[model samples]
Target: MRSAPRTEHVVQEAYVMSRDYIRYVTGRAAKAAPTVTAAALRHAGDDLLAKYPIFFKRWPRVFKAISSDNACDYLFNILDQHFQPDKPWQKKELTWSGILSIYVLAGQLAIHCQSHGMECVLEELEVRVGEYMEAKVCPGIREKGGWSGFVERYAEKEEPERAAVRACCGVLLLLASISLTYYMYRRLR
Candidate 1:
């Protein structure tokens, strides 16, 4: 026998719960307007939930989505938003490893958001990465221009389109790392 449909209240409650989790990871309150564009991400997650009631039951699907072509586009768009040459870069002296660390953290957070039935927008990801860089990488390189220096180097040497392409490559690398981690875990099991 088929099960009865869930009440609207139930669905709303689920969405609220998911939203709260997202806010916690994103470090933003529900009432606060997201500084970055995340509406699309949220909608995507909600849509997936509606189409597949137990979408979160399988972790792999969430992982796959974050690493998908769609995600690459999302990441690239956000980078383009922040790295416009018209606006000077703010932090520059961050080390390559520090940048990579921030990206890795972003990938982890993306996975977490997806697992909890939430979408992580590109702006949201960029904000989180920025915060991470400030907290972890800025201290060492604050004198060196922090993130601005890195951006200036790229902006001076590379065209905006090329920079965006490179950022996409970085996103792909993160996704590949996620895939590798999951494969290793499964193999161990």
Candidate 2:
């Protein structure tokens, strides 16, 4: 017997931000706002990779398989592991860096998939990242004065897009660094 349909309460407050985020990162931003372009998000990912090389190294298997059909599940698991909420019912309290890292991590997954000659997961990544941000991140981000505050904090001296030019620097390095991981994986066979 099927139970009654359950209705979900949807919040539209962060819809604009989420849409802008998906569009910008997926390269659909027609006008391309200066605040948080794809390049800026890439730059943020690059920074996160550089800052925590060891962290990426620990997830060789996960990174390698991140492009599979279950990609979003893996991404969500990583997000929850790294960015847990204070309580189950409470929303996450993220620093600006933390929020940026989520996108960066997704970017790394995309990079890994690309480097391995896999099909692009940008569409799935966009949806998963948007869902994560809207539900877990937007409230905290809003408290910090929204995306404008992000520009103030990280893009004070230059446009956030500039960072994108150097995007995936760390992921590139880690993939090479994973030459060792791959070697080890092969050795296990």
Candidate 3:
């Protein structure tokens, strides 16, 4: 006889569906806003935010959708409504969503700074991210011995993503490097 569906499994599916529905609703709201002219966004800016998967996976598409319009407001909406710090990743087990969302926010700030011709935005963003990680991520992630211990623990995992709960930043950095190098090579030619 086939085993009946487990209650836990059913609950998890519902939870995930709810999160997706929330995302869809907010995405609709973002779409309703006025868009900026192409001329305005052609100036471009750094994409430091794309380093983080969660936001990178979503924000750039939203940025494109509105033609770089209402970026700060959109970002705030993303942070306050979409991310919702209280949501707790995947129903309360350990995860990186909160801290990483803050990192992505810093990257967004950096992009805003670059577009506005503000100086030292990268440095400022780095400081903010570092402070945030220390304040938020370290408390949960650090082990008995501290940060190094946490690193050693995660390093032993056969699937780092399973332990870390996000795709490896090292791999993303390497890919970004390759893409940037190719772009620069083409530009010089």
Candidate 4:
């Protein structure tokens, strides 16, 4: 039987993978609608708070009584509840969007904890989130051809206005670089 990987190495690998995935998702070609990126997941979390203001209002008061372990449990439980509201047993069968939303919700929970003076939970939260994703979501992601498939499926279809803006920006950047080079050449002469 294979021995389990060291916790430290697993955590580091997860961190690297997460960073790369986020960079890939965010750096899609200009043709992609901006809403397809990770920012949309974060905005979903923000929308969650807006739709259910009671969670925000009660967190500080409830946080005072939660132990570190229980806090993580509570956070995951909330995520599961939110994502699998109708089918509790289907918690592990999250879609790609659901997987991403869990990550965003975890991040939002960390920020909420930090803001409420539980700064030390950040590292623990990171580890917990990594562990949870590896155990629960990684298999599904692999089955889907991973991040490339995610980007291909979700990142495309731009409006004409966004394409126009991107074209203008590219032209302006090229002109600015040429102008800077000419100025430098003149100064050196």
Candidates' C-alpha lDDT: 0.46, 0.60, 0.39, 0.57
Using TM-score, rank the candidates from best to worst: 2, 4, 3, 1
Assess every candidate by TM-score. Answer: 0.26, 0.56, 0.31, 0.52
lDDT of 4 by residue, 1-189 (tens): 212342533333444434333333333223322333433443444455667877566655655666655778887777656655465555446576676566655655665665667656666666776666676566566566555544454444578999999999999999999999999999999
Question: Where does candidate 1 stray beyond 4 Å?
Answer: 1-94, 115-132, 153-189
Best by TM-score: 2
Better of 1 and 2 by lDDT: 2
TM-score, prediction 1: 0.26
lDDT of 2 at 189: 94
Clash counts for all predictions: 12, 1, 0, 0
Better of 1 and 3 by TM-score: 3
Off by over 4 Å in 2: 1-40, 48-59, 86-92, 156-189
Q: What TM-score quantifies how close candidate 4 is to the native fold?
A: 0.52
Better of 1 and 4 by lDDT: 4
Residue 43, candidate 1: how far off, in angstroms? 24
Give the winner by lDDT: 2 or 4.
2
| lDDT minimum window of 10 residues, candidate 4 | 24-33
Q: Per-residue lDDT of 1-189 in model 1, one digit per residue for the tens? A: 212122333222223333443554455546532321133334333444566656345544434545433554454454445433553766444354344333433444565555555564634554544443344344454455333443343222347899999999999999999999999999999
Score residue 110 of candidate 3 by CA lDDT: 46
| Best of the candidates, lDDT | 2
